[model samples]
Target: MATLLLTGASGLVGSRLLPRLVEAGHTVRALVRGDVTLPAGAAAVHGDLADPGSLRPAVKDVEAVVHLAALFRTTDEDAVWRANLDGTRNLLSAVQAYAPRARFVMTSTGNVYDADATRPARESDPCSPTQAYPASKVAAEALVRESGLTWSVLRLPFVYGEGDGHLASMPGLVSRFGLHPAHTYSVAHHRDVAQVVKMALAGTLDSRVVNVTDDAPITVLEMTALAGSEVEGSAEPLTDPWHGRMDGTLLRELGFSPEVPTVQAAARAGIL
Candidate 1:
């Protein structure tokens, strides 16, 4: 079994991915800030992306690097850059220096894609991200491209399902606006997200940038219907603002069919 280095093994996606990786018999070297209980058959390695030097031994002997640690916040620019961009720069440099041959798979957002096109977004579309999160991710993508190491960038859109941050937050949004989201965007399931992450590390995916999301765009109206709240007359709040549109063609070509559809999975996860 090959050794895989997981950076954010404590996060929402990482928490889920950890068990699967261990069950698959892969030796998972999980990085954590302090003392935290690790699952069976997984090794806990202490490291911090902010401290680039700390990653030396963590990256050593690892066959692959699944870098998922990023500071994501729409309002805080300084914190976002420090966590997303700077951390990425440090980690990429360390990976290049230490495990140059290891495949570096990164979790990027579809927010980096242009929203003006109106059509479903694909991997080749020019990124015109207006928000700070996607904007930094755009820069992060550039770092990976220039790292001179084998890499795969999975651009995910509205990753949801039992997570604290997602459509579950829609009820609060509805209450804030006293209505549903006037604008709708593309989305993807969380467990499916884990599969996409694995695919990036496996290197079987032909496409470098695959849009990880649902087959077709699901509207906020449908989402709010699942929200179990009351809404007024047919007055939509705002125009359909494109946060991130995902074109999952490459995912299909790679034969990726997520077991749980985003909406249904959310309901099962108690989000709905």
Candidate 2:
């Protein structure tokens, strides 16, 4: 197994990923800003993404670096940009100085693609994100591509599982955004996401952007149902037909099929 350096180790996805990496016999050095319980067989390195100087120790001698740190929920655009874009640059700078030969796995959102996709978005699709979160990620992706390192970018769709409330909050998000219940989204379970990271670390994937999602697409109404809510009336047409759906053909081609193929499967497994 590889010696890995992981950022955002205390966050939802990273917390789940740490244990999986440990179980796989990989030595992981988790970067954290403060005190937290780390998985058994994982070491901790105190650092902040906003502080470049603090990241050196975490990056040193690691065979691969999985960067999962980013600001996903914030009203402040500057905060989002700083955390998503500038923070990535800072980490890359550390990687260049310390572990230049290490493989870099970036965690990016599928929202970076154009909103009005007719079919599921693919890695070759054009990017036209206008919002702060996705826009910042786009910029970060550019930085990673130009960083002179072996890199793989995983463009994730709506991820829900392992006690993450992302699926449960879907109904509220729909209400907040005034979205139609008929809107469908590509989704992936946290276990699948961890597997993707593990594969990236093992050098199974090439250096390219990959749309990572499950085989099936789930509707907003289904998500609401899974969240234990009831909705009434006919559904409205999707303004952006392919806003969330992403083609997982490349992911399957890479030989990593999802364990939980849909939100319903996740619910059945009690992970939602």
Assess candidate 2 and give its lDDT. 0.88
The lowest-lDDT stretch of 10 consecutive residues in candidate 2 is 229-238
**Candidate 1, overall lDDT?**
0.76
Best by TM-score: 2
**Regions of model 1 farther than 4 Å from truth:** 162-165, 173-182, 230-234, 237-242, 265-272
Q: What would the per-residue lDDT of candidate 1 be over residues 1-272, giving only the tens digit for each residue?
A: 56889988888677878888888778999988899988998899888888998988899868888888877744788888888899899988888888889888888887787757667677888887767788888998889888888888887776666654666566676676554345566777767787887777778652376778776566666766665653443564444355445777888888788666667565766753
User: How accurate locally is residue 172 in candidate 1, as Cα lDDT from 0 to 100?
Assistant: 72
**Candidates' C-alpha lDDT:** 0.76, 0.88
CA displacement after TM-score superposition, residue 240 of candidate 2 (Å): 0.7
